[model samples]
Target: MPVQVSPERFDEIVGEALDLIPEELAARMENVAVLTADAPSPTQRRGRTGRSLLGLYEGVNLTRRSPVRYSAVMPDRITIFRLSHCRIVRDEDELRRRVARTVAHEIAHHFGISDDRLRELGAY
Candidate 1:
């Protein structure tokens, strides 16, 4: 069965996961906003129907930025799908680990790491 948690508690878990990030990396994470949502919206889902997304990172990654062209842009968005996480875990410990892993995964995108690279690194 899915282990459910209150939204407030879930938010706390996300915060805790973020806090675990190294300070140097966190400091370099400029103009990014991390958010939590119940689930991804339909548009966000696009045409993928077979899998549920645990998180999403939307915006230009560090490697794609140029000092002249990157000015005055909107903040990068990293959204954690709270409901998806809650639906997959069996208990609080699993939930915490999953959330932490998801957060790290999304943050890696911000730093210009691809899913393929993550898999190569045994991070996935």
Candidate 2:
């Protein structure tokens, strides 16, 4: 079973995880929003079975964008699911580790890393 944490503490953990990202990557992160949600919405869970998502990246990947037409688009979004992550960990320390991993995994998606590649690199 997972451990419980106050919402404020969870947000702090998320912030800390984000801060752990490499400086070069963080500096290059443009028009991207990092958000936290209680859980994945129904639409996000469609076609999945008994699996919970810890984080999700939604938008055009950097590698797939057209240089001429990408400027006017909305910022990409990366949502970290708080309750889902909380429900998958054993303690605060584990929760922190999980948050860091989830954040990195989603950010990789932003960099055009596919799920299969993430799995190959053991980041998934």
Candidate 3:
């Protein structure tokens, strides 16, 4: 059975997962906001299996930015889908692991790491 949690508890888990990031990396993360949603919005679903989207990073990545061109932009958003995660995990422990992995994966995007590269590094 899928593990379920209150929104507050889920947010706590997300925070815990974020804390797993290395301090050096965390320090370099700028103009980014970490958020949690019960589920991805319809536009966010974007033809993918909605439940498959554990998290999303929406913004220009660091590597693609230029000091001159990158200015006056809203903060990047990294959204963790709480319900989607809850629908897939078997227990709280598994949920934590999954959330941690998803959080790392999304943060990697902020650092200009692509999913393909992450796969190459066995990060998946």
Best by TM-score: 1
Residue 22 of candidate 1: its Cα lDDT? 96
Best-performing candidate as measured by lDDT: 1
Model 1 residue 43 distance off true place after TM-score fit, in angstroms: 1.7
User: How far off is residue 82 in model 3, in Å?
Assistant: 0.7
lDDT per model vs. reference: 0.94, 0.89, 0.93
Query: In model 2, which range of ten residues has the least summed lDDT?
Result: 43-52
**Collision count for each candidate, in order:** 0, 0, 0
lDDT of 1 by residue, 1-124 (tens): 9988988999999999999999999999989999999999987788767777999999999999999979999999999998999889999999999999999999999999999999999998
- RMSD list, candidates in order: 0.9, 1.4, 1.2
Q: Give one digit per residue, the lDDT tens place, for model 3 in 1-124.
A: 9898999999999999999999999999988999999988988888786237899999999898888978999999999999889989899999999999999999999999998999999997
**How big is the RMSD of model 2?**
1.4
Instruction: Write one digit per residue (lDDT tens) for candidate 2, span 1-124.
Output: 8789987898899999999999999997777899888888988777767678888898988888887969888899999999999888999999999999999999999999999999999875
List pairs with backbone clashes in candidate 2: none
- Rank candidates by lDDT, best first: 1, 3, 2
